[model samples]
Target: MKKLIGIDLGGTTIKFAILTENGEVQQKWSIETDISNNGRNIVPNIIESIKYHLEIYGLSREDIIGIGMGSPGSVDLENGTVIGAYNLNWESLQPVKEQIENGTGIPFFIDNDANVASLGEQWIGAGKGSNNVVFVTLGTGVGGGIIAEGKLVHGVGAAGEIGHINVDPNGYTCTCGNIGCLETVASATGIVRLARDMSEQYAGESKLKYLIDDGQQVTAKIVMDQAKENDPLAIKVLDKFNFYLGLACGNIANVLHPETIVLGGGVSAAGQILINGVDHYFQKYTFPQIRNSTKIKFAELGNDAGIIGAASLVKRQS
Candidate 1:
């Protein structure tokens, strides 16, 4: 039974897992991301941790057939260099493949974190058994991954940017300098921004206003909770979010015609309300036949998706 190692590198934390060839997680752990010295310590720390865990489990690098890493930026799969990871503060491209492979004496592969997670879900979660799936993760910012015709769509290795799609011409400017991208209206930050703005416009009292009055940062969870209870202002904000998200999904359906659109990330914590709302608009905006055929659902793999997806990279190569 050959085993593999999976790594998910994020801005704050780096998660790792040991898994069987069939995608079962045998063991998993995480470590804080050390971005000091312009993130010089990040990769080294990961390498050390992997060594420590291997010793604890009484296994050697030779026991692992390969390693798959998911990082948060543009990566060149062929060369294993991260072009840029904004949140990780990688100022320039790093020879990530050389460093990791030299340290572990194992074959390694890499991909964008979002795309890795999408592959994870398709392998063992909501999109299981579906060769074509589009995964959208609605976190602080939106991230997307698309699988078309049983292949991960990598247009110059930077495709599947669903969030940056220009959904509104006059909407708020995104971090990417795009105005009114789907991310601006469908992400957790976007949800809070919409709720805060709407609360100010309305004269009546609202739960979100209480959070504002108390000096607490407004959160998407707060808005979703209030919306579930029928708060007029919160519902309005959610409607705006759902409209844009659904519109995005509809656009994806029209273009890729994927079998499933799996939603994940923090804002997706809203669960049924979030999916139901998005589904309504997705149905309205997608082509009539596509609208009915495409299944919209929640991601089943949550945090584990990263590791599962990373391991799939090795499986894919095999």
Candidate 2:
């Protein structure tokens, strides 16, 4: 039987998986990303790793249907090149598709990492069974993907940029050179920033303030945990985060009216509290019809979404 290969390329690690065409994983592993020399070594290392794994599994290039990869940056699908992947030190357009196809002698496919994750969710996770879905990832930075009518939307190759949505015109500057992008207020770093700002202005007793004074590294997790314990400062910051996140969702729903909006990433691990918090404001801004139709849920696949989603690229075409 033919097998499928999935790769999720990140700044730190490259996750790999061998899967059946049906989206079932047979084996999975990872390697540290060799981002040295302007990321020149990255593709070579991936080819070598895949070759080694193929040997171990007693499989050859012909036995695999295709290889799929999820990468960072703006992807040129027609050319299979990624642009502005600064984190990978890829200063210029990298011919990821050409290089991988040449090295592996197999068809290769690639998409934006976040978009691939959305495909993964839609295949077998939170967005399963939904023809239209939106996925928002709130981590160190925010990322997003949109699927409609059971297909990924890639309008001009920049369609699913949910992070860059301006939530606060007067909010802090985002790395993307924008003011108050959702990433600045809804991401993990954003949450911590909110905590620090609120603590300084807060006059009441706050364990969050005490922790900061004690030199404890205050993280988004800490903020959520503190809120769970009813810390006033933490609660205020979380409420703020939810407010922006909900507003973004409300606006997105008004346009797409997707069947579901799935939240993923490390910050989403706050679970029900995060969902409930966002839902409160989500209900306020959304139109009554859209509000009643859309549902916000947490991602089920977690980190694996990348691998599965990449593989689904090939599965989708097959």
Candidate 3:
């Protein structure tokens, strides 16, 4: 059986996996991403990690067909250059593909993590059999991917940046140097920020208050838990947050008209609260004719989506 290697590089963790040609994960491992020194050192660490995996499997370099990676910044996929990864402290990187290939003697490919994640879902997860789908990941920050006509859209490395779209002109500022980006009000951080602001306004008689007496450090999870317990304040926060999220989804649906919209990332663990809320507001905001056709669902692959999706890149090329 042919094997391929997939690496999902994040600011804090490196998730690597070896998989069969058919997308079955044979082995998986991870290591901390040490970015304190500089991002240039990550290449050596990744090579060493791959070497360890190869040694453990008793497999030679020739045993692997191809390698794929997902990075968290603007990537020139055709040239394998990472333009700017603020979180990784990489201003601009070149020859990342060359370094991996030279060290492992295998062909490699790389793309934006969110794009690869969308591919993963389409290939084996919630988006299976869907020709057009939009994927939104609601983590510390929001990230998105667009698949149209069974192809990943890459427009000068800027496509699928749904998170940066201006949702509210008067809303909070985003880390991307934009005001009122969807991520600022719909992401995990956004949820926490909303919780904090709401806690302050409500003052007493809020479960969120009980969780944090001073409301100095309420988290998204706390908010979700409170909502689950029927806390009025928490419910209100989610209602507002999900309304924005659904509005965003409705806009995408109107434009892309995708058959399905897949939601992923940590915040999705809120389950029905998120799905039902988004669905409700999406119906309210979406075009009347398109509302019934666009389906909303949760990503099934979860954390494994990146690795599996990375492996699917090889399949796609084949």
Candidate 4:
């Protein structure tokens, strides 16, 4: 049986997999992304990794159907190049498609990582059986993807930069050089900042204070855990996180009115508490019709999402 290759390329690691057309994983592995030489090694490393796996399985390029790749930054699908991937130290358009295709002799399709992850969820996870889906990832930074009318919307080359949506005019500057982007207030960094800032203002009655007083490093997880136990300050901080996130969701609802909004990433590990809070605020801010139609839920694929979503690229064509 012919199989497809799915690759999730990140700044730190490059995850690879072989999958069936139905988005089922067969085998998976990862390798350190060599960011040396200004990320010049990344594409070559990916090609070699895929070939290595093919050899291991006693299969050749002809036995594979195609390749699907999820990458960071704005992707020029027409030419298959990545533009401005700062995390990878990529200064200009990186010719990912040409390199991989030249080296492996396989047709490769690429899309933004967050977009693919969203596609992955829609394919076999939380958003299954739905065509209109929005996936928001609250990780070290916030990112998201949108699928509408049973298709991914590329809207120029920068469609799904959800993290950069302006939420606060007076808020701190985001890594993207924008002030008050959703990522500034709704990401892991944002959560920690909220906890610390709130702790400073109400320094006396918070578990975070105890942690700070004892020199214990406070993290987003610690804050959420404390909030789950009814810590006042932690609850306050989470309120801020949910407010911005929900506000973003409301804004998206007006634009797309997606059927499902799935939350993923490390911050989402806070679970029901996180989803419930965001859902509360989302309903509060969104239109009545949108509020009644959209459902918020947890992303189910976890680390496999990127690969599975990438695989779906091939699945769609087949």
lDDT of 3 by residue, 3-67 (tens): 98888888899999999987788999999988766587888899999998899999888888888
**Candidate 2 C-alpha lDDT tens digits along 211-304:** 9878889899999999999999899999999999999999999999998999999999998999999999999999999999999999999899
> lDDT per residue, candidate 1, 154-238, as tens digits?
9876798888998899999999987999888788888888877787787776776677667897788988999998887888889
Which one is best on TM-score? Answer: 2
| Candidates 3 and 4, the one with greater TM-score | 4
Q: Could you list the CA RMSD of all candidates, in the order they appear?
A: 1.6, 1.3, 2.0, 1.7
Instruction: Rate residue 151 of model 3 by lDDT.
Output: 93
Better of 1 and 3 by TM-score: 1
The list of candidate 4 runs beyond 4 A from truth reads 213-215
Q: What is candidate 1's local distance difference test score?
A: 0.90
What is candidate 3's TM-score against the reference? 0.92
Instruction: Please give the TM-score that candidate 1 achieves against the real structure.
Output: 0.95
Question: What local lDDT does model 3 show for residue 93?
Answer: 69
> What's the lDDT for all of these models?
0.90, 0.93, 0.87, 0.89
